[model samples]
Target: MNKLIAWIVFLSLALGGCATKVSTSFDRQADFSRYKTFCWLQGCEFTFTGPSYMNDSAVVNNLKNAIIKEMAEKGFTYDDQSPDLLLDFHVTVENRQTNVYRFEEDRFLQLDPIDQSDVYYFLEGTLIMDIADRETGQMIWRSSASRYLELNPEMTERNLRKGIGIVLKKFPPKER
Candidate 1:
């Protein structure tokens, strides 16, 4: 019973640590209200840095759709010809490993124990979104969301949507 409880606690901690993390920063002086329409920045729509598998078109489209949805929710329209704000996004994936040690009690001898160590490897992905003023060409707002990568296509799409939602939640920062 004690071992079962310990395992449950360990699993909870491990999974909780893998949750998505998001951070954002913006120019407080910038007039966010003036930004009405937005379009992808020239040569900066899809910036990716990672393995070939991580650069799939499906993933890119998923990200683009998610961003568009978020912007629309904020009453922003898409205007490619002449936009008030330029949008850019970047995706990066990196290898990461975690080491875990497991100890087991010897059934026959309680005094002796067995120690087992294991190293688990995974991919960590980060999504960065940048919003810049079209006329000034200066960044106005930026946000990034990071989490462990999943190989499954469905899971990947879900993660991207969730990450984008969380990062863009602070968009059009409340006037202070």
Candidate 2:
């Protein structure tokens, strides 16, 4: 039974780690089908905090390439001048402290609460992608992906691409 309990705990944590938290929102009245072209807004730059790697030019370029590929796969052409949709990217980092608790239970069905509270501080990064109507200059769609940053350069780049893909998958929001 102890082995079973251990396996259950391991599987639970493994599955939880595989889950990617993604969210998206859009203007309901916006006609997404009409958006066929995109361009980066003038003076666009990624905003970030924490380590330099988080805002490294190479890293930023890699992220942009990933986004461009995803957009093209979605049937949008990149137009330098005169585009239907304008795209913007922003990265925000925050230090988050979370407290985790552990409990002890007795065999007699009694529960004992101990002050086993553990506090963890981690850099939480958010990637925000905004799409707006080029002519009206009004945001029509937005997608955001957030994750704790703590990995090697290669893994970080991989995760960045994965995060962007997950966020953009909800593009052209489904009809009601």
Candidate 3:
């Protein structure tokens, strides 16, 4: 019985640790160093050209501010006109349902209790950031991150910042 309980606890902690995942890709031919100035283009939906999801201004503002700060820290100037890079952002949220099952052994070694099964429904959010060349209008770098969201605004902002920081860490790919 103790071994079963320990196994259950270990599984629970492992599943809970599956948090945000971030991935990035960039054009190899593009000279990242040439991107000195950037300006915000309207955030896209998914196709990179579709209308943006602007249902909440507060959320949008928070994201824009975070991106600006991150870019500035990377030594990129924010320019509205004639910028070297154009930055576009997109966000999506999905409701995910997961079932967690707990098991108990019986004397027969075949019977197990199913009463510990739990269903969880939570929001998973994805944010995509694209950097494109203003002159050629070609995408140079792109990053996308997906993570579980918090209900509180403050917590949500903190998570957003953390996610963005992680995604942009590899920006301007190191010269080889």
Candidate 4:
């Protein structure tokens, strides 16, 4: 019974640690209804700043596609020639390390280990999106989502999609 409880507790903590964290802030005074057309900020669709693994074309494409889809679903049209809002995004990945201590009991002797601390390393990735008025060039809305990245390409892609979706979920903030 004790062993089973220990395993359950350990599993719960491990899973919860990998969950994504998202935050959003917007200019309360800005009128969201006046925005309709959108275009990428500067000459590029998106900008990335991170290690080589996260700065590849595939990552950029995935980010762009996710954002475009979200914006389109929100009744926003993409126009480079003339737009009411300019959109920009930045991606960053950093190495992180953490020390975790777990109590381990000797299966045969039922004695706890003296030292059960372990060091774990992971890659933390963050996606930041910004929306600014074209004429004023002042940011109207912004959001960011961060999570520990998986080594697998498929899982990484899934995480990216999920993060982008959550980040933009509150865009075009309701009138206050």
Among all candidates shown, the one with the greatest lDDT: 4
In model 2, how large is the Cα lDDT of residue 6? 39
Model 2, range 78-141, lDDT digits (tens) per residue? 8876789988878776776655444444421343435654555556667788889988999998
How far residue 148's Cα lies from its native spot in candidate 2, in Å, is 3.7
The true-versus-predicted C-alpha distance at residue 76 of model 2, in Å, is 1.0
Expressed as tens digits, the lDDT of each residue in 3-54 for candidate 4 is 4645555567668877778899999998899888998898634666556766
Scored by Cα lDDT, where does model 2 land?
A: 0.70
Every candidate's lDDT: 0.75, 0.70, 0.70, 0.75
Looking at candidate 4, what is the lDDT of residue 99?
A: 51
Candidate 1 clash figure, as a count: 0
lDDT by residue (18-105, candidate 3, tens digit) is 6768889999999888789888765322123212543456555666677778889999988876788888877777767665555555
**After aligning candidate 1 to the native by TM-score, how far in Å is the CA of 176 from where it should be?**
1.5
**TM-scores of all models?**
0.80, 0.72, 0.77, 0.80
lDDT of 4 at 165: 83
Better of 3 and 4 by TM-score: 4
Task: Assess candidate 2 and give its TM-score to the true structure.
Answer: 0.72
